[model samples]
Target chain A: MTRRWIRWLPAIAVPAVIAAGVLIVPLSANAAVDLPAKTPQQVLEMVATTSVDAFSGTVVQTADLGLPELPQIGQTAGSGSNAPGTDSGQTASIAAALEFLTGTHTARVFVDGPTKTRLQVMDSLAERDLVHNGSNVWLYDSAKNAATRVTLPQGDATVPNDGSTTIQTPAEMADRLLASVGPSTTVTVGDNTRVAGRPVYDLVLTPKSADTLVGSVSIGVDSETGLPLQVLVRARGQQSPAFRIAFSDVTLTAPSAGLFDFTPPAGATVTQQALPQSNSATGHATMPAAPPTVTGTGWDTVVSLPAGQGTSTMLDSPMLAQVTTSVSGGRLLSTSLLNVYLSQDGRVFAGAVPLSVLQSAATGR
Target chain B: MLGALAAIPVLIAIAVRVTSGSSSGRGPAFLDQITQNGLFVALTAMVVSTPLFLPLTVGVVAGDTISGEASHGTLRYLLAAPAGRVRLLVVKFVGAAVFCLSAAGSVVLAGILIGAILFPVGPVTLLSGDTVGPVESIGRLALVASYVAVSLLGLSAIGLFISTLTDVPVGAMAATVVLAVTAQVLGALPQLDWLHPWLFTNYWLGFADLLRQPIAWDSFGSNAVLQLGYIVVFGALAYSRFTTKDVLS
Candidate 1:
């Protein structure tokens, strides 16, 4: 019996070794040893100085804003009247924005220099491609088979100033988070790791303010390339991430020029428009736009938009009153990621923190 | 049986192309990626087969490994040939695992051949939206196929254990299949979610992470660990039971 058991050892040993080889080692084999180390400040400085001429990759974004069960944003757009307790267009836009922020989406992003960028958000069996080639920008919606082309005025037009298009990427979010890292944030360096097989270092920024719900944000920057790999945002009192966007794969080669060229598909509707030009030449700074004022610094930063621009009348709307609860001197609408304060004095305050932060900013606290 | 089973992926690929223009509800996670390149045919083949067809084929083959010989009265002859009971059991388990790989491999091979001819074969747009060359895509497909084959290790071991108990091959086969389905059913229950990580099928779909741009290793790594755990435990149980059991045949 002992001899029989000994014969069986080879079978067990071989498979055991094979299993261990395939299952165990490779999981942690991602990062190589003998990599250089850098402080968080150095990493950030390196990231800020590095410039990417052109590249393309896939990005996945997930947002968990502590939102309640919302109606499917896709089918709810024009069909809002079909559902009770749904305001037609106003609430739908907010719901759409919320839906856009929350769920996981796979987007194909191509950047050929800063001036030429293309982003295509993939949907089931369809896609939406946003192509900006110099002064000519095209937004192609395959679901609707509609393409909108906007021509920029000469060289100085920021034609794609629309909020939704610009803030969709992890790199863009990293820029915003890093820009906010001044006196209000405590920056530290994390351990070295790998992203897309490139050595990367994590720069962690923690907000010193206690009034906000934001805990900290960690940015993964490729050590050699200085490109941002991932961005993770965790709210206060939560161990898990509240929002994250990262590349599952990436290539740093310059994209082909033809990728930026856009032509509307056959039988697709096309709309053309011209954007207002930025006038440093005009000398008046154009329309005398009211600057966005921030009342608090760092994590508790509450940004208030100028009041009495038809926004005050929006506060009295029945739909707005139905969804929001009357706070101290304002109507408060809260979601997991953002809090909006509509003060009775016609001020609009928004932040990722809390309603109190927004209220304080409204009251100039 | 293997030949017939291998043809399923090719047939599914044809069916997918036939219904490409029509809505088939939500088919899989990366339908756009699949539609972009025919190479993903192998991925779609494996994805569709893992939950039911592949496991079913695995159960039948593994279930027959020992019981078929016993039912045919060849088990005693084989053992009398100086092949110890333990050695014979090990060989049977290894044979079953090879069949699992070949069965899935045949699907992949057929998918590549048929898919290359039918659909546009080019750089695959990964789930992460990064484009990988055809050769690299093939490598990823090989990885996916192998990972899938490895994922069935637990089921194969369990089936082998069931084979040792019964002399009827069909009964053992049916029992193994039922157990797989039962594990899946239990895994699906929200109340029994705690049992999901322990279930062999829990990480079957974890291969999706492999297609990410940077390749998320956590889920796929956990899958292998869990499957390895199942293999060790069930393999030991099979060894213990077969060693002291009476062989009337």
Candidate 2:
């Protein structure tokens, strides 16, 4: 009986492990995940090296509205909304929620109809980018000339901001969106369509992760130049409130440097409090080592951080286009409309991977 | 026109809940559920509108019932005979209550029929907390219709109180409708919540609350108890005032 049972255990064990893996850990932290990395400089060079035609179009947005009984000023609670600790609706679209994840940004989104347009802005929002710069995970505030670290409410979690992270540059957003999905993401080609004067490839990004926030995403690219012309996001949970960023007025040539500088409207408060900085400040850094591979998967990189050791940004479905990337312990995760940021102390004196390789090398140990 | 007029608001409330507000969602409080519950809807419309309008109809009958007889000198001839003054007053009060109750009764019966035909029944949706399913809508509507009955006590009390004051029933009936409306208007103000505990209109407001999701039992329970108190006090006032008043005329 023992010998027969032992023989049967192997078959059951594999399926059991697979089920356990899908449930216990979040999809963002797959140990055997790998992405191809390209640096900001490298990303810029890729853009500089390519030639594309400029297409002028308009962006449109449709929003659904609902009204609920509201608590009066200073009234902490009201009759209709009595669920303690749970907000009646989602808060993914609040300006404070996504203010930090992005640097200076821009994007051009095409609405469904031909005649309408919408302007999506990504200027240096004061006090918004303090945390990212202070934490040194990303950009410095152009106005403050100070490293910005996004400040989070003591115990609250954040969603990734789609506009700043995804639309910083046309190429960066496209590449990041392409990289965020994994091998499990299914790909398909759509009906031939033309935007501007160029034909484009239509790519849909479905999360390979078992639990993905994105229900569906479609990107229209300039087939001639490989540049993305438009992107659309469909998410879950944001029934009453939805997020949409359609960029119009595409200017490839710099808009006279003054367009990026942001000055606060007069009388707006500028409260500055220096953030605590340390070498291990991100709390997501680890001693650098060579990227490793999983035992069975064919991917080149393996990020095998133990459970509860990483911070990640995600766009939870209800608030489609709303994104969050967080880092805890030795793992960092960031999400933008275009790119997913994952990094550790990839800058080691010996056998360390490059910072840009973090997302691609995740499949490697 | 009167029947259709009173039926309209109740029906509108029911249709609104069915059309948009959580279709199968968290049900309204016992008060709010009335909006969806067919029987309560009918009862509410009948109770409220009849008090304001039907009394005038009753007054026309009453005004003629007494003064027409008095104009013919039947009261003087009858007073000279064995019939006592108290019996006449008693009969008048009873007849008026019966008439008012019967009119208001249509609100209840109509509410039931309308609720059965229009609302999805059986599982009751609670206003604040949920204990609802499709099957409860019927049973829940039936339960809430009782509150409308409680609301009608004021109508009868006012009618009876005024009926004792005069032989001309028309004047008494018109005066009663005006008093009821004044009370209701006073009760409707937002600032009245502090005084709602004291107002008889509090019971009328109770029926409206039944339409809210997750039936609020606390409000319903309190309204029911307070409503009984109003009936007892108001009934006693009408009885005492009628019993002691001059009847020689």
Candidate 3:
């Protein structure tokens, strides 16, 4: 009996060894690292002054806005509806935009300077690529079998912000968050950690006021390169991050030059466009009507759109009605970090504040 | 068995030819592309069969490895000969692994040949909207087959271990197939998110990464590592049981 049991020893030992290795490897990789200490101001100055560019990495964005899960009635209900009028059309477009904000998205980013860049959003069995090389920009969608070419004016190399490209890297998101680091925010260094296998300093920004929905923002600044590798936003009283964008893998080396060159494949519907001169400089021409007026400043700011901006038609849609609840004055769409109030009139109010604040702002207007 | 696997792509291609209608984005992922490019026929067939058909066939073959010989009253004679128990176990595993490879190969080969006969063949458009010549596309198809072959190896090991425990070949086959289905069911449950990564079926559809413009090797590498771990753990278990068990039949 003893000899027979010895024959089965390998079976028991092998699995135990593998389970131990699996548990230990990740713990060792995430072990605490000691880096050169730097104050919050010094880290902010490092991020502002660093000029390391021309790198390639893969970025993943995840959002958990605490929105109710909508049933899968059909793709037509969420996508472009065949209904003729602008009422269903605008509602369909808003529904489509909300789809991007709910799911996890993975995109490969390649930048070879300010002029040459490429972003490939990888979906399930499909891809959408935006290639910017010099004055030429190509947007290709494999599922639709369509390609669009936009020609920028001479000496203009920046990607046109047409609101279609909602995916952003950690660096771009950090820039937007850092702009709000004035008197209303308190900045401090939380911990020294590792991101994308590199040492990083966690710069935490906490809002001084309690009115804003945002609790705090944490940025992972690469210790050596000063590039922001990750940005995490947490809503008040939420344990998990409300929104997160981070580099899963990254390298500082410049990508291959051939990656920037894009020619529309045969059998694809191609459309040619030119970037408007005025829109190219400002980069915020998403709305056709006048820009919404701001009510307050800093985190408590509320944006109010005037009447006749098509807010009533969107609120009337059955799909939007499922997510929004009726408030005292209008329908209210509330999320963990943002709120929108659509009044009985065509006026609309939106902010990152609470629902009560948005309701008060609407009544005050 | 490979003949049946090859017939899948042929039937799919002929049906598309007869219907002569666009897929309208219904059915499997690449089913809609089959009308425009014949090469998509192979991809669609692979995607359709991966979840159930491939696993079922692999389970039958692997589950019959040891039990079939015992049920036929040939195990005692074979061991009575010069063949050692350890060498016989290794041979059975190698036989099952070969079947996994041929099963994937037949589907891909039939897809390419039928697609060429039915539609106009040209440069293949990848998932990234970039076009590659015929040579590179064939190379990519081969890699996809190998990735699928690797994906099934873990299930084969599980089936082989189960075969050593029973004298009835049918029971072994059914049990193996049940385990595969159970793993897939557990993988689909969102509440069991922590257990999803450990399932063997998690990366079965990851071969689509091979079709990208600059192929992503992350899934391929991860799948290979996970399968190798399964093989080591179960191969030892099978060895322990097969060597210690008596061949009274």
Clashes within 3 Å, all models in order? 5, 86, 0
- Model 1 score (lDDT): 0.71
lDDT of 2: 0.41
lDDT score, residue A356, model 1? 62
Candidate achieving higher lDDT, 2 or 3: 3
lDDT per residue as tens, model 1, B61-84:
999988899999988888888779
What order do you get sorting by DockQ, best first? 3, 1, 2
Chain A TM value for model 1: 0.79
- Candidate 2 regions exceeding 4 Å error are A1-365, B1-105, B115-124, B129-136, B190-194, B208-249
User: A1-365 in candidate 3: lDDT tens per residue?
Assistant: 98789989999999999999999988987888799899999999989986878899889998878886433234333332333235555455555467556656788899898888888887666677898999898888776566888898899766764334568889988988998789988999988888889989999999887888999999999999889999999999899899999998998999999889898877777978667743533232224266788987888889998766356556667878888899998988888888988888868889989988888888885
**Candidate 3 CAPRI level:** medium
In candidate 1, position B227 carries an lDDT of 84
Give the distance in Å from residue A154's predicted Cα in candidate 3 to where it truly belongs: 3.7
Model 3, B45-133: lDDT tens per residue?
A: 89978888889999999999899899999888889989898888889999999999999999999999999899767778887778888
RMSD values, in order shown: 8.1, 26.5, 3.2
TM-score of chain A of each: 0.79, 0.34, 0.89
